[model samples]
Target chain A: MRVVKTGIAGTLESSDVMITVSENTSTGINIELHSIVEKQFGKQIRKVIKEKMEELDISDATVSVNDKGALDCTICARLEAATYRAAGIKHVRWEEK
Target chain B: MEKLRRTMLYVPGNNAGMVKDAHIYRSDSVMFDLEDSVSLSEKDSARLLIFNALKTLDYEGIETVVRINGLDTPFGVDDIKAMVRAQPDIIRIPKADSADDIKAVEVLIEKEEKLAGLKVGTIKLMAAIEGPLGVLNAYSIATASKRMIGLAIGAEDYVTNMKTKRSPGGVEILFARSQIVTAARAAGIYALDTVYSDVNNEEGFLEEVRLIKQLGFDGKSVISPRQIAPVHKIYTPSQKDIDFALRVIEVIKEANEKGSGVISLDGKMVDKPIVDRAERVIAMAKASGIQFDEEDDK
Candidate 1:
């Protein structure tokens, strides 16, 4: 799915990550991540974001995350929320494998 | 099937820090709250957070409960749809006014359980009676469905409905509390008291706990982690009670062996009700981790 508008999800609270997805005219996915635990889990968080974007079938977008030690599941949920908001889709099929 | 619910700690559904570390506090149950604790704009986010937490985190055998939004709200349907898939131990319904309110939610839970390939009654329900109407119909609400295991009082709303606020002496809520406990007892379900709300006032908190216990409440809802220990301590069966129960059990066992229907201890006749109470005492003792020597009398 392609992004229709800017969408944001999550919060800056400890053990949470806020993600903002905006439409990008560029060729590929661009991600900017800011996290306190960047030295340890930065690469892992980036990889998860990229994987989630691919799973949603979005190849081009500007995604940014401000993470505060959130877990992988939390990150995925926020990404899905932001993607849905950006795509302007309601009624998310959450259980679709 | 009756699990210990002495202390249920409420963790805001959107607060990942508290949700992740909730099990460490060792409440008998950790309630992921998606109702009042969450703001309207963040309702969807909080639901997602709790769903993910339930799916990913290991609660270390602590019973997981979720307090969902009321069915009247737009978020309630989706809240139940997401939470049931996560398979919490109990779903607490807020502002439950009658049997219909409970049945409405139960129907949805039944549908979700079937779709998820889970046993139909695996997810239990706990109704929170927070209004005068709910208090009056407490019995029917408690027995509305087979999945309902308990009923809890939410005093904040109840007092508001009563045109008053919560006083330290709890004079305003005595009748409501008594009504709820009686209804729960009549239905053979657990009755849980509301939160004390004053985390700093230890004396007042203890007084409320004592009153609830005296009125025969099974347990209480605790807002902070500091409240868990006191509730558990008060609910634990005393040593004297436990020892008496053990003796009663031993006497009953000997009577059973000899095919004698009549039994007595210290010239006091023991009956089925007495035996049942003794068994419950022993169960409570075991659940509380109190050790006793079985061979002392042997």
Candidate 2:
């Protein structure tokens, strides 16, 4: 799996690691996610994100996530972050456009 | 009636081998499906087989639910009529578009219950909002029936109806899932994510489960027996979570004893929301078969 950075700043929160996908590609996705806050919760990060992706049919890419200090909600936010970046949605910049 | 903490394995109503062996698979819930899995001709036999399995099989500690046909279908009424007689733990009504659909089923269930001399509310209800109309009307469906314990999406159907092809990482149904979760939570009911159909793709299924849980779903539906263990493994509360939950409970108890509405813990406010979250952790722990102290409940 290639981590293609769309060079977008869709950082949902500084504390959370976010990943997004480009909206144009709709295929099938595979993701393997792990959390660092508690290693035992490794499976949790994977399970939650997988369900969200499939329910939404995000299959154009495979996402491998290694998370540190993340909660249940952050997993979604981060995945959305990656998705938004890939979708080419412009992030709010510090300077007016 | 137990909290569905692990996998809900879906067994095709027509597949007797899978149905018989399903008990040994060790799922928290076994949903014998009468939808999608069975063809139109097999509906009657499938219903009979499911009824027999419910009546005869020894599904120890496994919640047995029948995914009945939609209210609009001819088999929908028959499926409920026969399955309700068996009195499974939960009745999963598929393709429910509104509260009216659920209410009609509830009335039928009540009628069946009375006829069978069972309790009026014996069988809990769950609806699968599978279409665009259903997704938009999720709230009404959830609140329509008191018998409803959960709401789920028919991912395949929803995807087809939306006419959006799958993306590699799954970005399409995000809005619908979030909507269902919000509606379910608002209605004070359990929200279940749809099945991950590709059984061979373990990594894909795991990621989806994680996302659904993050989206605030209580559990997920699995199409194969192999999917159950992984889902259960993820849902099992971690030691750290258990410890924190216990601590939260302890602090809340201290505050409660002192006539305080809130307490301080870990340098954060422990109000109702915090306490409620802690309670959820404990509840999930309990359902996961994790050990904890009675004082863990403030």
Candidate 3:
């Protein structure tokens, strides 16, 4: 799925990550991440974002993540939701994932 | 055994923090709402959030309920499709005025259950009676589908539909409450009372809890974590009552041992109803983590 518009999901809550997916930049996936626990888990968090973006087939988009100690599952959920919203898709094919 | 449902806590579907930590509150059931509590603009976002939460998070065996939007709305069908696949313990139907309204959702749930590789009846149904029409047809709605497990009162809308507001004593919705409770009993399902919106008024909340407990409600829908403890305390059997219940059980067991068809305890006949009540009280006591002697006197 391609990010046609800038879609945002999640909150700045203590255990949540706010995901902002921008329109297709056509230069592969670019990620900018700011996190509370970046020093200890920055690489792990980036790996999650990159893997989730690849899983959703979201190519060539500017992805921004503001993490507040959210878990791996939460980060994946928020990114998938943001990607779908940017793609203007309502129905989620959960079985495929 | 009947499960203790003294408190069913409402957690907003969109709040990731609450969704992750809801089970720690120890409510009998945690209901994630995709309806009125969530704003219109965040409908898609909230649905996706709750779906993932249900699929991944460990609720630690506390019953999970998801209140979906009405089938009339644009988002309602999507809510059902996602929530059915997500597999919460129950899905509450909002504005369920008639059996057809519930059947509409059930049909979709059945189909989704198949596609999701789950048993056809894996997901249960709970109806929210919100208006005078629904109150009148309470029994039908309660028994609408075999998957129906409860009927909950939505007093805010019911009171507004009656052209009034909630009073201090809840006099206006008395008939609705009694009727819903009666309908639920008649249908052999659970009867859940509405939420007390006055979160700060502990006295009033206790009073409402007492009234509903007296009226034979199985539980109350609570909005705050603070409301849960009081409801559990109120639902817990009193020590005096528990003592009497223990005696009743002892006598009944002794009679059965002696091949007696009838039993008497404290000069009154202990019938089936009495035994059932005693068992229920014991169950509640056990649920409250109360322990007493169980050695046989014989």
Candidate 4:
């Protein structure tokens, strides 16, 4: 679940969110979210990202998202895609233990 | 259950925006495409995205179909594995040439259904006969499994196999289209015509729809949202046809009650096939939101 390299997923297209996970020297996870709906759904979006990162046991990485009004499922999917790419994993087993 | 499939819209599997909002368009079926629409590197991403979208998004009871890559590609097995778990109404097999192609995917679907604890045979199959071999074996492919609900002609690959490009008149694909429709009819399944790629040409699209309707296609596969209403309009039974069908059903019911085998309407003899067609017209009319009271006939 370690971030081995810079991994990016998703697109900047409307209803999609672009996520990037890269190495960070900071002690804790750092997230920077840029979204038009930041005033309203920002907290929830960040919570989703953080929860996915935590599920992957990723505690220390710099994550950035440029969201274009993506839904909760899209956000989670993009996060999972970026996380798998960052961990150098090719296939994702969503049901895996 | 015979569902209305007049307009099956193809949305790229990788596009989250389209997937989330597809139901709003009211297409008879929203086909999440994982085949030609997706590039090589994005196959996995598209599959995963579609899986999650199916699990989370509400298609509002619209039929959800996914066109998976051919088994020749490495991605096909994984696509089936993931898609079957998501439980779409139908899985469209691309470039399917023979019964074996459908059976192979059915085997995988069976395994996935068991592993996922889904009802066996819950997911139906549709085949896209895209090449010459596929067209030649259309009937076998259409009847290969009980799970198959429809057969569609993919004209792009078909015309290429014929060494020609698509013309406005569509002379090259007439044979293939006819063959597919006949086979689907023989198999008692639906026959869906391929997409009209030129979304901007309203005249050309309507003309093609008219041709397919004349050729007895049950429905069509559509690429864009704009094509939906036109196809549905062309497929919906007219008011006259609906009225005739209701009268036919009423007469047939009366004849049955009287223990009579022969039925006639409007000085014309009515038989089983005619009654079947009439029933189909009423079904189409009802599906298209044309309401009529059956109690009125009583």
Candidate 5:
């Protein structure tokens, strides 16, 4: 899998990610994503990130995401995660700080 | 056979006015749709509205269910988490194709239940069988989760995926409908026929409902309130039918008291299964507030 770092610069407190996916005739990608934020707003934050990802129009790819107190910039990481999954790279892990 | 529901009106989660007036329509079950009815931009807001509505409103004997987004989508997981927290009587999952899909949902349901501090398995689920693959795997999907109380066909999505046209009386969906009902019955769960989309075609609508009931579906998923009265009318047991059912139950009970496993009623054999059907009829009568004879109990 190849990793491309495409970033969005904005004052938005959340992250934005844009990606394109291509896969071969072999194995498919399995992508899983999760986000952990302040418990007070964890549910709301998760809802927002998920809504964005669902809005993304992509097929033939599996995307997994994990969130840890991520702002709008986290969208880049999500795209990266999706890219990695699409490319069949399994070693890279996303962690929450 | 169960009471028929000709109209299964769908209300979007974000529509407050529709939600408020839903009960007055008196459909069999109000499906608070959060899947296609919701746009990605408004999922969060929609969830909040549905949550608040389920929490505060009284539907007066109306069954409540929420149709979550497909598991393949990001919104799907979040939809389940939020609605599960609110605890609707049932969570309807869309685009399910296999037992694995049901199991995958069960895992997430368990986690969400823990987060919400609710007992595991407290909430029930229904699967909407939409594609050919889903139809093929109907039996496995029905049995995949003990939480699954029923199975429903999704005609709009299924027809689109199969690239077929919707014919009058839903001839295109007839085969899938048959397979689903057979599967649901084999698994001992309710089989719900898909929505009749042509709201203005009442004659076509009732005809379809009759065909579905004849096919042994427990009920139907409706799309409009106007269709509900007809569906209920068709499914409700007639007085003559109810009277016969009661007699069958009485003979079965007497035989059981005498340690006989079966009995004859009006020259036909009767057993526990026959009595069970009678009980359902009685229960339906009670739920629908229909009057029945007190002597039938004996």
Candidate 6:
């Protein structure tokens, strides 16, 4: 899906991730992740972000993640929420996901 | 056996820390709130958070409940879609005024349960009678759906709806509380008292706990972890009570073995109601960590 505006979800609280999804005039998905356990878990965190975005069918968006040791589920949750908001969708179509 | 719900701790759905470690406090149940405590703006996020937590976390022994927003709001239906899919032990309906309120939620719960491929009635319901109408129809709401396991009073709203405020002894909400307890008893469901919000005032909290306990309530809802221990302490059967219950069970068993219709203990007849109370006391004793031989109780 094409993101028209900036969509933000989650928080930088402990065990949470604050994510922002915005329009990417450029092609494809771009993610910038800043996490405490970056050195050790950076690859897994990026993989989760990409995977959830793909699940939402969001192929073109600039995603920014500020994670404070969030788990994989939290990352997926934040990513999905942010992507939905960015798509300008008010009611979630849960069946699709 | 009636499940022991001495305390059901309320954990805000949006708080990542509390939601993650709520089961550790050891309350009989933990209710993650997706309504009132959560702001409208963050409703979506909180729902997602709780759904994910319930999906992944294994809260072994403690029962898990989620309080979804009312059908009156925009977020309520969506809340149901996620929570029913997550499959917590129970789904709590807030500010239910009539049987229809619960029926409305049940419709969504069943649909989602079907979609999730879980049994139709696997998820249970608990209604919080928060207004005059809800209190007046407490019996109907308690018996609304077969899935209802308990009815709880939401004193803050009930008091407000009655054009009064909560007092130390809870006199303003007495009628509402009585209706809830009576309805629950009549319907054969659990009567759960509202939360005692004053976490610091031990004496006041203790007084309220005792009042509800004496009023035939099965248990009280607690807010903090510190509150759990005190509620358990009050509900714990005393040594004397435990012994009497044990003797009552032993006598009944001996009578059964001899094929005698009449059962007596200490020259007094043991009636059905007395036996039931004895069994309940034993259940409470065992739940409170009192050890006894199972065969002896039998």
Best by TM-score: 3
For all predicted structures, in order, the TM-scores are 0.93, 0.71, 0.95, 0.94, 0.70, 0.94
lDDT of 5 by residue, B1-298 (tens): 2443334578876555666567888887888998898777546545555665676678886778899887898677777777777778888989889999989888998988887778999888889999999999999999999999899999988988889978896878988999999999999888898888889989998898889988988788877777888888888878887788778777777787898865788787776677888887777766566765677655
Candidate 4 segments exceeding 4 Å error: A94-97, B254-263
- Binned by DockQ into CAPRI classes (incorrect, acceptable, medium, high), candidate 5 is incorrect
Instruction: State the lDDT of candidate 6 residue by residue for B162-257, as single tens digits.
Output: 889888988898888888999999999998999988889999999999999999898888889999988889999988888899899888888889
Q: Write the per-residue lDDT of candidate 1 for residues B34-134, one digit (tens) a residue.
A: 99999997787788788888998899999999999999999888888888888888999999999999999999988877777778898999999999999
Residue B49 lDDT in candidate 5: 54
Could you give candidate 3's per-residue lDDT for residues B223-296 as a string of tens digits? Answer: 99999999999999998888898888888888888999988887999999999999888888887788766572
lDDT of each: 0.90, 0.73, 0.91, 0.89, 0.70, 0.89
- Candidate 5, residue B265: the lDDT equals 81
Instruction: Specify the poorest-scoring 10-residue window by lDDT in model 1 chain B.
Output: B289-298
Interface RMSD, all candidates in order, equals 1.8, 24.3, 1.8, 2.1, 13.1, 1.6
- Estimate, for each residue in B174-229, the C-alpha lDDT of model 2 and write its tens digit: 98899999999999998988878778888888899888888888888887777888
Model 3 chain B TM at 0.95
- Using lDDT as the measure, name the better of candidate 3 and candidate 4: 3
DockQ of each: 0.60, 0.01, 0.61, 0.57, 0.02, 0.61
**Candidate 4 chain B least-lDDT 10 residues:** B289-298
Candidate 3 chain B, run of 10 with poorest lDDT: B289-298
lDDT per residue for candidate 6 within A1-97, as digits (tens), equals: 6688999999878998999999997988898989999999999999988888787888899999999988887787778788878988876776543
TM-scores for chain B, listed for all candidates: 0.92, 0.92, 0.95, 0.94, 0.89, 0.94
lDDT of 1: 0.90
After the best TM-score superposition of candidate 1, give how far the Cα of residue B75 lies from its true spot, in angstroms: 0.3
lDDT per residue as tens, model 4, B159-267: 9988999999999999999999999999999999999988899999999999999999988888889899988888888888887988898999999999999989999
Better candidate by DockQ, 5 or 6 = 6
Ranking by lDDT: 3, 1, 4, 6, 2, 5
List where candidate 1 sits over 4 angstroms from the true fold.
Answer: A95-97, B251-272, B295-298
